[model samples]
Target chain A: MERIPILKMGKFLIVSIQVDMHDELALALQEDLAEQIVKTRAKGVLIDISSLNLVDSFTARILGNMTAMARLLDAETLVVGMRPAVAMTLVELGVSLRGIRTAGNAEKGMALLEAIVAQQAKSNAPKST
Target chain B: MPPKVRDTFTVRSDHDVVTVRQKARQLATELGFSLVNQTKLVTAVSELARNMVVWGGGGTVRMEIVKNGALQGVRLTFEDHGRGIPDIEQAMKDGYSGGSGLGLGLGGAKRLVDEFDIVSRVGKGTRVTITRWK
Candidate 1:
Protein backbone atom coordinates (compact mmCIF):
# COMPACT_ATOMS: atom_id res chain seq x y z
CA MET A 1 0.00 0.00 0.00
CA GLU A 2 1.23 3.50 -0.82
CA ARG A 3 1.85 5.72 2.17
CA ILE A 4 3.19 9.14 3.02
CA PRO A 5 6.74 8.88 4.35
CA ILE A 6 7.27 10.01 7.93
CA LEU A 7 10.84 10.90 8.74
CA LYS A 8 12.16 11.33 12.27
CA MET A 9 14.64 14.10 13.09
CA GLY A 10 15.77 13.88 16.69
CA LYS A 11 12.55 14.39 18.64
CA PHE A 12 10.42 15.63 15.75
CA LEU A 13 8.75 13.97 12.75
CA ILE A 14 8.58 15.54 9.30
CA VAL A 15 5.77 14.74 6.86
CA SER A 16 5.66 16.39 3.50
CA ILE A 17 2.44 15.89 1.60
CA GLN A 18 3.24 15.77 -2.11
CA VAL A 19 -0.02 14.46 -3.53
CA ASP A 20 -3.58 15.68 -3.52
CA MET A 21 -4.64 12.90 -1.21
CA HIS A 22 -7.99 11.15 -1.26
CA ASP A 23 -10.00 11.00 1.95
CA GLU A 24 -8.90 7.44 2.66
CA LEU A 25 -5.25 8.36 2.31
CA ALA A 26 -5.70 11.37 4.54
CA LEU A 27 -7.36 9.27 7.22
CA ALA A 28 -4.64 6.69 6.93
CA LEU A 29 -1.99 9.34 7.35
CA GLN A 30 -3.66 10.65 10.49
CA GLU A 31 -3.72 7.21 12.01
CA ASP A 32 -0.15 6.45 11.01
CA LEU A 33 1.19 9.72 12.36
CA ALA A 34 -0.52 9.24 15.70
CA GLU A 35 0.93 5.74 16.08
CA GLN A 36 4.40 6.99 15.10
CA ILE A 37 4.28 9.77 17.65
CA VAL A 38 3.46 7.31 20.42
CA LYS A 39 5.94 4.67 19.32
CA THR A 40 8.82 7.09 18.83
CA ARG A 41 7.90 9.41 21.70
CA ALA A 42 8.23 12.37 19.34
CA LYS A 43 7.90 15.87 20.75
CA GLY A 44 6.74 17.67 17.62
CA VAL A 45 5.48 17.11 14.07
CA LEU A 46 5.99 19.31 11.04
CA ILE A 47 3.75 18.75 8.03
CA ASP A 48 4.76 20.41 4.77
CA ILE A 49 1.91 21.04 2.36
CA SER A 50 3.52 23.45 -0.08
CA SER A 51 2.89 21.10 -3.00
CA LEU A 52 -0.79 20.69 -2.26
CA ASN A 53 -2.62 23.35 -4.26
CA LEU A 54 -6.13 22.21 -3.41
CA VAL A 55 -7.55 21.51 0.05
CA ASP A 56 -11.26 20.78 0.33
CA SER A 57 -13.21 20.73 3.59
CA PHE A 58 -12.62 17.03 4.04
CA THR A 59 -8.89 17.51 3.67
CA ALA A 60 -8.97 20.45 6.01
CA ARG A 61 -10.85 18.48 8.64
CA ILE A 62 -8.42 15.60 8.43
CA LEU A 63 -5.44 17.88 8.87
CA GLY A 64 -7.09 19.41 11.88
CA ASN A 65 -7.81 16.01 13.30
CA MET A 66 -4.21 14.94 12.85
CA THR A 67 -2.98 17.99 14.70
CA ALA A 68 -5.38 17.41 17.56
CA MET A 69 -4.37 13.78 17.78
CA ALA A 70 -0.71 14.73 17.93
CA ARG A 71 -1.43 17.08 20.79
CA LEU A 72 -3.12 14.32 22.73
CA LEU A 73 0.10 12.31 22.38
CA ASP A 74 2.13 15.22 23.85
CA ALA A 75 3.46 16.24 20.43
CA GLU A 76 3.01 19.57 18.69
CA THR A 77 2.01 19.78 15.02
CA LEU A 78 3.16 22.74 12.92
CA VAL A 79 1.90 22.87 9.34
CA VAL A 80 4.15 24.73 6.96
CA GLY A 81 4.08 25.92 3.35
CA MET A 82 0.44 26.88 3.05
CA ARG A 83 -0.05 28.82 -0.17
CA PRO A 84 -1.69 32.24 0.05
CA ALA A 85 -4.61 31.00 -1.97
CA VAL A 86 -5.06 28.02 0.29
CA ALA A 87 -5.10 30.30 3.31
CA MET A 88 -7.81 32.42 1.75
CA THR A 89 -9.92 29.42 0.87
CA LEU A 90 -9.58 27.93 4.35
CA VAL A 91 -10.79 31.10 5.98
CA GLU A 92 -13.67 31.45 3.56
CA LEU A 93 -14.61 27.86 4.16
CA GLY A 94 -14.78 28.60 7.91
CA VAL A 95 -12.37 25.81 8.68
CA SER A 96 -10.22 27.75 11.06
CA LEU A 97 -7.49 25.36 12.13
CA ARG A 98 -7.24 27.24 15.40
CA GLY A 99 -5.25 24.74 17.43
CA ILE A 100 -2.67 23.84 14.81
CA ARG A 101 0.40 26.02 14.34
CA THR A 102 1.51 27.28 10.91
CA ALA A 103 4.64 28.66 9.30
CA GLY A 104 5.67 30.10 5.97
CA ASN A 105 8.23 27.44 5.05
CA ALA A 106 10.25 24.50 6.34
CA GLU A 107 13.02 26.64 7.76
CA LYS A 108 10.59 28.74 9.77
CA GLY A 109 8.59 25.71 10.77
CA MET A 110 11.70 23.99 12.12
CA ALA A 111 12.50 27.02 14.21
CA LEU A 112 8.97 26.94 15.62
CA LEU A 113 9.28 23.27 16.52
CA GLU A 114 12.64 23.72 18.17
CA ALA A 115 11.33 26.53 20.30
CA ILE A 116 8.20 24.62 21.27
CA VAL A 117 10.13 21.49 22.18
CA ALA A 118 12.67 23.52 24.12
CA GLN A 119 9.91 25.20 26.03
CA GLN A 120 8.35 21.90 26.84
CA ALA A 121 11.68 20.65 28.16
CA LYS A 122 12.05 23.71 30.34
CA SER A 123 8.58 23.44 31.74
CA ASN A 124 8.89 19.73 32.24
CA ALA A 125 12.35 19.83 33.83
CA PRO A 126 12.56 19.52 37.62
CA LYS A 127 13.00 22.92 39.27
CA SER A 128 16.28 23.65 41.00
CA THR A 129 15.86 25.04 44.51
CA MET B 1 -18.25 36.21 -30.51
CA PRO B 2 -16.95 34.64 -27.28
CA PRO B 3 -15.42 31.19 -27.34
CA LYS B 4 -17.64 28.31 -26.32
CA VAL B 5 -15.73 25.52 -24.59
CA ARG B 6 -17.24 22.84 -22.34
CA ASP B 7 -16.09 19.55 -20.84
CA THR B 8 -17.58 16.99 -18.44
CA PHE B 9 -16.01 14.72 -15.84
CA THR B 10 -17.46 12.12 -13.51
CA VAL B 11 -17.38 12.35 -9.71
CA ARG B 12 -17.75 8.93 -8.14
CA SER B 13 -15.42 9.00 -5.14
CA ASP B 14 -12.84 11.04 -3.23
CA HIS B 15 -10.27 10.43 -5.96
CA ASP B 16 -12.61 11.97 -8.49
CA VAL B 17 -12.74 15.08 -6.32
CA VAL B 18 -9.03 15.63 -6.87
CA THR B 19 -9.47 15.02 -10.60
CA VAL B 20 -12.15 17.68 -10.79
CA ARG B 21 -9.94 20.12 -8.90
CA GLN B 22 -7.05 19.46 -11.27
CA LYS B 23 -9.28 20.01 -14.29
CA ALA B 24 -10.70 23.16 -12.76
CA ARG B 25 -7.22 24.53 -12.08
CA GLN B 26 -6.05 23.76 -15.60
CA LEU B 27 -9.06 25.49 -17.09
CA ALA B 28 -8.61 28.48 -14.80
CA THR B 29 -4.93 28.78 -15.68
CA GLU B 30 -5.61 28.45 -19.40
CA LEU B 31 -8.15 31.23 -19.03
CA GLY B 32 -5.33 33.54 -17.76
CA PHE B 33 -6.71 33.94 -14.28
CA SER B 34 -4.48 35.16 -11.47
CA LEU B 35 -3.05 32.57 -9.10
CA VAL B 36 -5.36 33.69 -6.31
CA ASN B 37 -8.38 33.51 -8.58
CA GLN B 38 -7.30 30.10 -9.84
CA THR B 39 -6.90 28.82 -6.29
CA LYS B 40 -10.26 30.19 -5.23
CA LEU B 41 -11.97 28.61 -8.22
CA VAL B 42 -10.26 25.28 -7.67
CA THR B 43 -11.19 25.26 -3.99
CA ALA B 44 -14.80 25.96 -4.87
CA VAL B 45 -14.75 23.08 -7.32
CA SER B 46 -13.24 20.83 -4.65
CA GLU B 47 -16.04 21.59 -2.20
CA LEU B 48 -18.77 21.02 -4.75
CA ALA B 49 -17.24 17.80 -6.08
CA ARG B 50 -17.05 16.35 -2.58
CA ASN B 51 -20.66 17.31 -1.92
CA MET B 52 -21.70 15.48 -5.07
CA VAL B 53 -20.07 12.28 -3.88
CA VAL B 54 -20.90 12.42 -0.19
CA TRP B 55 -24.31 14.06 -0.24
CA GLY B 56 -25.61 13.76 -3.77
CA GLY B 57 -24.22 10.20 -4.08
CA GLY B 58 -21.97 10.80 -7.12
CA GLY B 59 -22.50 13.08 -10.09
CA THR B 60 -20.90 14.84 -13.05
CA VAL B 61 -18.96 18.08 -13.25
CA ARG B 62 -19.26 20.22 -16.39
CA MET B 63 -16.63 22.83 -17.13
CA GLU B 64 -17.13 25.62 -19.66
CA ILE B 65 -14.81 28.37 -20.75
CA VAL B 66 -16.86 31.47 -21.47
CA LYS B 67 -16.07 34.96 -22.68
CA ASN B 68 -18.23 38.07 -22.61
CA GLY B 69 -16.62 40.71 -24.82
CA ALA B 70 -13.35 41.39 -22.97
CA LEU B 71 -14.01 39.28 -19.89
CA GLN B 72 -13.04 35.60 -19.88
CA GLY B 73 -13.84 33.00 -17.24
CA VAL B 74 -14.51 29.38 -16.36
CA ARG B 75 -17.97 28.13 -15.43
CA LEU B 76 -18.55 24.90 -13.50
CA THR B 77 -21.80 23.00 -13.08
CA PHE B 78 -22.27 20.07 -10.66
CA GLU B 79 -25.32 17.84 -11.17
CA ASP B 80 -26.36 14.87 -9.05
CA HIS B 81 -29.52 12.79 -8.99
CA GLY B 82 -29.27 11.63 -5.41
CA ARG B 83 -30.79 13.01 -2.22
CA GLY B 84 -31.55 16.61 -3.06
CA ILE B 85 -31.51 19.44 -0.57
CA PRO B 86 -34.85 20.27 0.98
CA ASP B 87 -34.06 23.85 1.91
CA ILE B 88 -31.45 25.64 -0.20
CA GLU B 89 -31.49 28.77 1.91
CA GLN B 90 -30.65 26.86 5.06
CA ALA B 91 -28.02 24.87 3.29
CA MET B 92 -26.50 28.07 1.94
CA LYS B 93 -26.12 29.46 5.42
CA ASP B 94 -22.54 29.51 6.69
CA GLY B 95 -23.07 26.92 9.42
CA TYR B 96 -25.92 24.71 8.29
CA SER B 97 -24.24 21.52 7.28
CA GLY B 98 -26.43 18.43 7.34
CA GLY B 99 -23.44 16.13 7.40
CA SER B 100 -20.46 16.10 9.72
CA GLY B 101 -18.80 19.12 8.12
CA LEU B 102 -17.96 22.72 8.83
CA GLY B 103 -21.14 23.67 6.96
CA LEU B 104 -19.25 25.88 4.53
CA GLY B 105 -19.88 23.82 1.41
CA LEU B 106 -22.47 25.91 -0.37
CA GLY B 107 -21.83 29.30 1.20
CA GLY B 108 -18.07 29.12 0.97
CA ALA B 109 -18.20 28.11 -2.68
CA LYS B 110 -20.50 31.02 -3.36
CA ARG B 111 -18.12 33.46 -1.68
CA LEU B 112 -15.22 32.20 -3.79
CA VAL B 113 -16.96 32.59 -7.15
CA ASP B 114 -18.32 35.63 -8.88
CA GLU B 115 -21.67 34.04 -9.73
CA PHE B 116 -23.48 31.13 -8.04
CA ASP B 117 -26.77 29.37 -8.59
CA ILE B 118 -28.33 26.22 -7.19
CA VAL B 119 -31.57 24.28 -7.73
CA SER B 120 -32.83 21.14 -6.05
CA ARG B 121 -35.88 19.05 -5.20
CA VAL B 122 -36.49 16.86 -2.17
CA GLY B 123 -36.61 13.52 -4.01
CA LYS B 124 -35.27 14.33 -7.45
CA GLY B 125 -31.74 15.82 -7.54
CA THR B 126 -29.60 18.97 -7.33
CA ARG B 127 -27.56 21.17 -9.65
CA VAL B 128 -25.12 23.94 -8.70
CA THR B 129 -23.47 26.33 -11.11
CA ILE B 130 -20.61 28.70 -10.33
CA THR B 131 -18.41 30.98 -12.41
CA ARG B 132 -15.30 33.06 -11.89
CA TRP B 133 -14.12 35.78 -14.30
CA LYS B 134 -10.56 36.55 -15.17
Candidate 2:
Protein backbone atom coordinates (compact mmCIF):
# COMPACT_ATOMS: atom_id res chain seq x y z
CA MET A 1 0.00 0.00 0.00
CA GLU A 2 1.23 3.50 -0.78
CA ARG A 3 1.99 5.51 2.35
CA ILE A 4 2.65 9.11 3.33
CA PRO A 5 6.26 9.70 4.38
CA ILE A 6 7.17 11.03 7.81
CA LEU A 7 10.41 12.97 8.25
CA LYS A 8 12.06 13.74 11.57
CA MET A 9 13.45 17.22 12.25
CA GLY A 10 14.92 17.77 15.69
CA LYS A 11 12.11 16.97 18.13
CA PHE A 12 9.39 17.25 15.52
CA LEU A 13 7.99 14.84 12.94
CA ILE A 14 7.06 16.50 9.63
CA VAL A 15 4.46 14.90 7.33
CA SER A 16 3.79 16.44 3.93
CA ILE A 17 0.59 15.20 2.27
CA GLN A 18 1.05 15.41 -1.48
CA VAL A 19 -1.67 13.06 -2.70
CA ASP A 20 -5.46 12.90 -2.72
CA MET A 21 -5.57 10.47 0.13
CA HIS A 22 -8.05 7.65 0.29
CA ASP A 23 -9.81 6.98 3.58
CA GLU A 24 -7.69 3.93 4.34
CA LEU A 25 -4.52 5.85 3.58
CA ALA A 26 -5.54 8.64 5.92
CA LEU A 27 -6.34 6.13 8.66
CA ALA A 28 -2.99 4.45 8.06
CA LEU A 29 -1.19 7.75 8.44
CA GLN A 30 -2.96 8.38 11.71
CA GLU A 31 -1.72 5.05 13.02
CA ASP A 32 1.79 5.41 11.60
CA LEU A 33 2.15 8.91 13.01
CA ALA A 34 1.07 7.87 16.47
CA GLU A 35 3.58 5.04 16.46
CA GLN A 36 6.39 7.26 15.22
CA ILE A 37 5.62 9.83 17.88
CA VAL A 38 6.06 7.21 20.59
CA LYS A 39 9.12 5.60 19.03
CA THR A 40 10.96 8.86 18.53
CA ARG A 41 9.50 10.45 21.65
CA ALA A 42 8.82 13.47 19.44
CA LYS A 43 7.56 16.64 21.03
CA GLY A 44 5.55 17.90 18.04
CA VAL A 45 3.99 16.75 14.77
CA LEU A 46 3.88 19.11 11.79
CA ILE A 47 1.43 18.15 9.02
CA ASP A 48 1.86 20.03 5.74
CA ILE A 49 -1.14 19.78 3.42
CA SER A 50 -0.05 22.48 0.99
CA SER A 51 -0.48 20.25 -2.04
CA LEU A 52 -3.94 19.06 -1.03
CA ASN A 53 -6.83 20.98 -2.54
CA LEU A 54 -9.78 19.15 -0.98
CA VAL A 55 -10.61 17.55 2.34
CA ASP A 56 -13.85 15.66 3.08
CA SER A 57 -15.56 15.11 6.40
CA PHE A 58 -13.91 11.75 7.05
CA THR A 59 -10.48 13.12 6.20
CA ALA A 60 -11.09 16.13 8.39
CA ARG A 61 -12.10 13.88 11.26
CA ILE A 62 -8.99 11.78 10.80
CA LEU A 63 -6.85 14.89 10.98
CA GLY A 64 -8.60 15.90 14.17
CA ASN A 65 -8.24 12.39 15.55
CA MET A 66 -4.51 12.42 14.79
CA THR A 67 -4.00 15.57 16.80
CA ALA A 68 -6.07 14.25 19.68
CA MET A 69 -4.09 11.02 19.71
CA ALA A 70 -0.82 12.92 19.68
CA ARG A 71 -2.01 14.99 22.59
CA LEU A 72 -2.64 11.84 24.58
CA LEU A 73 0.97 10.88 23.89
CA ASP A 74 2.19 14.24 25.17
CA ALA A 75 2.82 15.70 21.68
CA GLU A 76 1.29 18.62 19.82
CA THR A 77 0.05 18.41 16.22
CA LEU A 78 0.04 21.48 13.95
CA VAL A 79 -1.45 21.36 10.46
CA VAL A 80 -0.24 23.82 7.82
CA GLY A 81 -0.69 24.85 4.17
CA MET A 82 -4.46 24.59 3.93
CA ARG A 83 -5.82 26.16 0.76
CA PRO A 84 -8.50 28.82 1.21
CA ALA A 85 -11.09 26.77 -0.60
CA VAL A 86 -10.39 23.72 1.55
CA ALA A 87 -10.76 25.86 4.64
CA MET A 88 -14.08 27.20 3.47
CA THR A 89 -15.40 23.76 2.66
CA LEU A 90 -14.22 22.43 6.02
CA VAL A 91 -16.14 25.11 7.84
CA GLU A 92 -19.23 24.48 5.75
CA LEU A 93 -18.83 20.79 6.42
CA GLY A 94 -19.10 21.56 10.14
CA VAL A 95 -15.77 20.03 11.09
CA SER A 96 -14.28 22.30 13.73
CA LEU A 97 -11.00 20.35 14.18
CA ARG A 98 -11.21 21.63 17.71
CA GLY A 99 -8.00 20.28 19.20
CA ILE A 100 -5.84 20.52 16.07
CA ARG A 101 -3.85 23.70 15.44
CA THR A 102 -3.50 25.10 11.92
CA ALA A 103 -1.00 27.52 10.33
CA GLY A 104 -0.57 29.15 6.96
CA ASN A 105 2.73 27.54 6.10
CA ALA A 106 5.43 25.16 7.29
CA GLU A 107 7.62 27.93 8.70
CA LYS A 108 4.81 29.30 10.83
CA GLY A 109 3.76 25.81 11.77
CA MET A 110 7.25 24.92 12.95
CA ALA A 111 7.46 28.11 14.95
CA LEU A 112 4.07 27.43 16.49
CA LEU A 113 5.13 23.91 17.33
CA GLU A 114 8.28 25.18 19.00
CA ALA A 115 6.34 27.67 21.08
CA ILE A 116 3.82 25.04 22.15
CA VAL A 117 6.53 22.57 23.12
CA ALA A 118 8.31 25.28 25.09
CA GLN A 119 5.11 26.08 26.87
CA GLN A 120 4.60 22.43 27.70
CA ALA A 121 8.10 22.16 29.11
CA LYS A 122 7.69 25.30 31.18
CA SER A 123 4.47 24.01 32.65
CA ASN A 124 5.96 20.63 33.39
CA ALA A 125 9.07 22.10 35.05
CA PRO A 126 9.37 21.74 38.84
CA LYS A 127 8.51 24.97 40.65
CA SER A 128 11.24 26.59 42.75
CA THR A 129 10.72 25.88 46.43
CA MET B 1 -31.14 22.53 -21.49
CA PRO B 2 -29.29 19.30 -22.08
CA PRO B 3 -26.10 17.95 -20.57
CA LYS B 4 -22.96 17.77 -22.65
CA VAL B 5 -21.63 14.79 -20.77
CA ARG B 6 -23.06 12.20 -18.38
CA ASP B 7 -21.59 9.21 -16.54
CA THR B 8 -22.18 7.01 -13.52
CA PHE B 9 -19.81 5.34 -11.08
CA THR B 10 -20.41 2.78 -8.36
CA VAL B 11 -19.84 3.59 -4.72
CA ARG B 12 -19.26 0.29 -2.97
CA SER B 13 -16.44 1.19 -0.62
CA ASP B 14 -14.30 4.00 0.72
CA HIS B 15 -11.93 3.57 -2.24
CA ASP B 16 -14.85 4.20 -4.58
CA VAL B 17 -15.46 7.54 -2.87
CA VAL B 18 -11.97 8.63 -3.94
CA THR B 19 -12.79 7.65 -7.49
CA VAL B 20 -16.03 9.64 -7.35
CA ARG B 21 -14.17 12.71 -6.08
CA GLN B 22 -11.59 12.52 -8.89
CA LYS B 23 -14.28 12.23 -11.53
CA ALA B 24 -16.19 15.13 -9.96
CA ARG B 25 -13.08 17.34 -10.04
CA GLN B 26 -12.36 16.53 -13.66
CA LEU B 27 -15.95 17.15 -14.77
CA ALA B 28 -16.28 20.31 -12.67
CA THR B 29 -13.07 21.72 -14.10
CA GLU B 30 -14.03 20.81 -17.64
CA LEU B 31 -17.38 22.49 -17.12
CA GLY B 32 -15.53 25.78 -16.39
CA PHE B 33 -16.24 25.91 -12.69
CA SER B 34 -13.78 27.92 -10.64
CA LEU B 35 -11.31 26.20 -8.34
CA VAL B 36 -13.44 27.04 -5.33
CA ASN B 37 -16.55 25.64 -6.97
CA GLN B 38 -14.71 22.51 -8.03
CA THR B 39 -13.48 21.94 -4.50
CA LYS B 40 -16.96 22.38 -3.11
CA LEU B 41 -18.44 19.93 -5.61
CA VAL B 42 -15.77 17.35 -4.94
CA THR B 43 -16.15 17.69 -1.18
CA ALA B 44 -19.90 17.38 -1.44
CA VAL B 45 -19.58 14.27 -3.56
CA SER B 46 -17.14 12.80 -1.08
CA GLU B 47 -19.54 13.28 1.80
CA LEU B 48 -22.54 11.86 -0.07
CA ALA B 49 -20.54 9.02 -1.53
CA ARG B 50 -19.32 8.00 1.90
CA ASN B 51 -22.86 8.18 3.22
CA MET B 52 -23.97 5.86 0.45
CA VAL B 53 -21.40 3.30 1.44
CA VAL B 54 -21.47 3.56 5.23
CA TRP B 55 -25.20 4.14 5.70
CA GLY B 56 -26.88 2.95 2.53
CA GLY B 57 -24.78 -0.24 2.24
CA GLY B 58 -23.70 0.67 -1.32
CA GLY B 59 -24.91 2.78 -4.20
CA THR B 60 -24.06 4.61 -7.44
CA VAL B 61 -23.28 8.23 -8.27
CA ARG B 62 -24.36 9.72 -11.60
CA MET B 63 -22.58 12.78 -12.95
CA GLU B 64 -23.81 15.14 -15.61
CA ILE B 65 -22.29 18.25 -17.15
CA VAL B 66 -25.45 20.23 -17.70
CA LYS B 67 -26.08 23.40 -19.66
CA ASN B 68 -28.95 25.84 -19.57
CA GLY B 69 -28.35 28.37 -22.34
CA ALA B 70 -25.37 30.42 -21.14
CA LEU B 71 -25.08 28.70 -17.78
CA GLN B 72 -23.14 25.49 -17.25
CA GLY B 73 -23.41 23.33 -14.20
CA VAL B 74 -22.63 19.92 -12.73
CA ARG B 75 -25.38 17.61 -11.51
CA LEU B 76 -24.84 14.57 -9.35
CA THR B 77 -27.44 11.97 -8.38
CA PHE B 78 -26.69 9.45 -5.67
CA GLU B 79 -28.98 6.39 -5.49
CA ASP B 80 -28.98 3.48 -3.14
CA HIS B 81 -31.24 0.50 -2.42
CA GLY B 82 -30.08 -0.02 1.11
CA ARG B 83 -31.82 1.03 4.28
CA GLY B 84 -33.54 4.34 3.58
CA ILE B 85 -33.72 7.30 5.90
CA PRO B 86 -36.84 7.51 8.03
CA ASP B 87 -36.94 11.20 8.96
CA ILE B 88 -35.39 13.28 6.21
CA GLU B 89 -36.07 16.62 7.91
CA GLN B 90 -34.25 15.59 11.05
CA ALA B 91 -31.52 14.00 8.95
CA MET B 92 -31.05 17.21 7.04
CA LYS B 93 -30.45 18.99 10.30
CA ASP B 94 -26.84 19.06 11.41
CA GLY B 95 -25.61 16.69 14.13
CA TYR B 96 -28.13 13.98 13.38
CA SER B 97 -26.62 10.74 12.16
CA GLY B 98 -28.00 7.26 12.49
CA GLY B 99 -24.52 5.96 11.92
CA SER B 100 -21.18 6.77 13.46
CA GLY B 101 -20.66 10.03 11.60
CA LEU B 102 -20.62 13.71 12.52
CA GLY B 103 -24.20 13.96 11.09
CA LEU B 104 -23.11 16.80 8.80
CA GLY B 105 -23.29 14.69 5.67
CA LEU B 106 -26.81 15.53 4.52
CA GLY B 107 -27.06 19.16 5.63
CA GLY B 108 -23.53 20.12 4.66
CA ALA B 109 -23.92 18.55 1.22
CA LYS B 110 -27.11 20.50 0.69
CA ARG B 111 -25.24 23.72 1.41
CA LEU B 112 -22.47 23.08 -1.12
CA VAL B 113 -24.63 22.88 -4.19
CA ASP B 114 -26.97 25.41 -5.74
CA GLU B 115 -29.86 22.94 -6.08
CA PHE B 116 -30.67 20.00 -3.84
CA ASP B 117 -33.41 17.32 -3.80
CA ILE B 118 -33.92 14.09 -1.94
CA VAL B 119 -36.46 11.26 -2.03
CA SER B 120 -36.63 7.98 -0.18
CA ARG B 121 -39.07 5.21 0.63
CA VAL B 122 -38.95 3.35 3.91
CA GLY B 123 -37.38 -0.15 3.59
CA LYS B 124 -36.76 0.56 -0.11
CA GLY B 125 -33.92 3.05 -0.82
CA THR B 126 -32.90 6.70 -1.11
CA ARG B 127 -31.99 9.13 -3.87
CA VAL B 128 -30.22 12.46 -3.47
CA THR B 129 -29.61 14.90 -6.31
CA ILE B 130 -27.43 18.01 -6.14
CA THR B 131 -26.47 20.59 -8.74
CA ARG B 132 -23.94 23.44 -8.74
CA TRP B 133 -24.17 26.10 -11.45
CA LYS B 134 -21.28 28.09 -12.87
TM-score of each: 0.95, 0.95
For model 1, name the residue pairs that clash: none
Candidate 2 at B63: error in angstroms?
0.8
* Candidate with the greatest DockQ versus the true structure: 1
Please tell me how candidate 1 rates in CAPRI terms: medium
**Model 2 stretches astray by more than 4 angstroms:** none
lDDT of 1 by residue, B1-134 (tens): 64465789999998898888998888888778888899889989988998889899999998998878878889988999998999899899887775745778899899899999999998889999998999
Question: Which lDDT tens digits does candidate 2 get at residues B1-134?
Answer: 45654888989988899899999999888778888889988999998999999889989999987777888889999999988999899999988876645778999899888999999888899999999998
Candidate 2: the clashing residue pairs are none
Error of 2 at A59 (Å): 1.0
Query: Tens digits of per-residue lDDT for model 1 on A13-113?
Result: 99999988987788889989999999999999999999998777778888889899999999999999999888987887677887879999999999999
Which DockQ values do the candidates obtain, in the order shown? Answer: 0.74, 0.71
